[model samples]
Target: MTDKNPDKGFVALLGWSLNAIEAVDRFDRRYVVVAPPWAEDYCRQNDIPFVPWDFDRLNERSHELALTLEDMGVDVAIPIFEETVEWAGAVNAVLLKNPRLLGQAMLFRDKSLMKRRAQLGGIRVGVFEEAHDRGDVIRFLKRVNQTLLKLDGDPNDPIHFKAFDKSGTAGHRVIRTPEDVDNIPDEEFPALLESHLDGWEFAVEAWIKNGKIEFLNISEYVTLGYSVFVPATPELEAHRERITEEIEKLIEVFDIDFGFIHPEYFLTSDNKLYFGEVAYRPPGFNALELIERAYGFNGYQGLVLAFDPKTTQEELDAFFPKEVVDAKGHAGCFGVYPRRRVVSRLQVPEETANHPYFEFHELSDPREQKVAKRSAFGTHWGLAYFFGDNAHDLRDLLKRQEELDYYV
Candidate 1:
């Protein structure tokens, strides 16, 4: 372990991410990993500073965590996953001596509350409501299309169904027909319902300190769950100034003081911007690794910087490189999901592997003879990474991979 500086803050990471632990392990801050009991043996074997605590839904004993970290001389708590965001808030409410921090964390966790809050704050968002049952979903689907002025025999406009607190695309579903609503599982109810906003949808990763955005990067999505590339295409990058303005509005509205937030947005064809929900933790699909590959900086370390109250402006200026001007090339990745329902092997398409932008992939052989039908935008089997100089070429390359079968 790298020796920690005595003068800086001691942080408690609220979940397990080897990438996060490794980053903190090499940095100057004293830290400990707090996760479930399952991680205890691994932490012991690897010499990772650890505190095994079950981070389930908050219970009567949640406050005990704050007192424990306080007794240990820990200065701050940082969340590393979706579920941990609430715990970090509950703990930081005590550590930072600000009770409102706990409530602020809830706004980030709950999607319906987040949209309502954003609406109250003057951030544009699509029409949304909470659904308690399948009946509610069907009504919402019909109501949204009605508001859109659909005529008889006109196809219904799609509405989105999402779990209130899940991470990106996990509980997300598109409902264009009543038949689609029937496919939803019962346990997924009491979710957020949103009217589909047409146009380009993308995500923005921002690091905030002292209630100001220090660094912002636009992540362009070729397809929502299938592929993403950083620094965006020139078409999307064209909205940087306005996007920055919107992010500034977000910081003010959310009352966020420090740490990283990955919030998505919708840019309409006419150039209007709308807020999608914001996540308090790191994004899925290895966004940090892609940023590191393109920008030559450790995002996890930058997370440490943003969360530490003692971070200096000079340090912030030095740690962050010029956004688009400093990137070496566009770094993109395709999430490979087997198209065929029955597949037995992993095959890399020759066209994909032969491209100069092709770097490496982590695909593996099938474990079973039958592949489960994808529910919504199901999880990818693994990711294929690529690097190149042109964003348009990278975008096209990522889109083309959707047609080729990776497993057969």
Candidate 2:
């Protein structure tokens, strides 16, 4: 076990993530991993402080874990994944003696509720509604297209279907026509549907303290769910002031005081910024790692500092570096999904491997010869990393990867 400052907050991390665990292991603040029982043996071997608990849906038994952590003198609970966000809130509400925290976490978990809350707070958002079945989805698609006055021959504007609680693109699908609605499985019903916003989509990572923004980094996406780079290009960077204001508004609306927030936004051609959705935990696609690569700082440690009530202004001020100015270079990653229907092996294209920006990849050999049909935004096989001094070159390099074959 690493030495910890007894005076600092003792946090309960309500999920298992190696990156987060490694960060807390080296930081001053003490933490305990509250994960499923499967991790018990690993935690014991590694000497990691652990409390095993399955994060199933909350029930009457949920308070037992909260009381247990409170008895352990835990000051707060930090969620590392979407599944644990509600768990963290439930536990923190008991530990911090604030019941409202649970409600706030729900806003981060449920997309339908989140949009309603954002709209009530006067945040701009695209047209959206909850869908309970295929009929509901079809009706929504027709209504959205009709509202746009889309002619019968005109291509229907696509609408998005997303699971209320799943993270990333786990249960996301794009419905462009009535026939497309038939492809949705019955289990994926009770989802949130939204009109596709035509604009530049980007995600913001903000660390807040005392209802103020301490540090914010923009992650520019080359293609949604495919590639993203930190400390966005100059054109996107120029809107920092406007973006910051929107973040401040999010803080006010969400009543968020501390910890990290990963919220996505779309800047329309008209320059109007529309709120997408926000997650209370760290973003997927290795965004924190990319941020750490671009700026010489540990983002998971930043999460600890932000959540620790004992953290002082001097500590935060000294921790994060200047946004774009402090970045060493642009760090980006492209998620690789096999383009072909069947693949016998994983092959990194020579053009990709020879590129100056190419750093490395996480791809491995194929486990099977047949690749299944992808539903919605399916999972990527792995990611390829890159770094360069020029953002445009990095962006172009990432975009070009989509055309290359990574498997055969």
lDDT of 1 by residue, 10-104 (tens): 99999989999998999989998999999999999999888889987555566999999999988889999998999999899999899998999
Residue 355, candidate 1: how far off, in angstroms? 1.0
Evaluate all candidate structures by whole-model CA lDDT and list the values in order: 0.92, 0.93
Candidate 1 clashes: the total is: 0
Residue pairs with backbone atoms closer than 3 Å in model 2 (clashes): none
**Whole-model alpha-carbon lDDT for candidate 1:** 0.92
Candidate 1: where are CA atoms >4 Å away? none
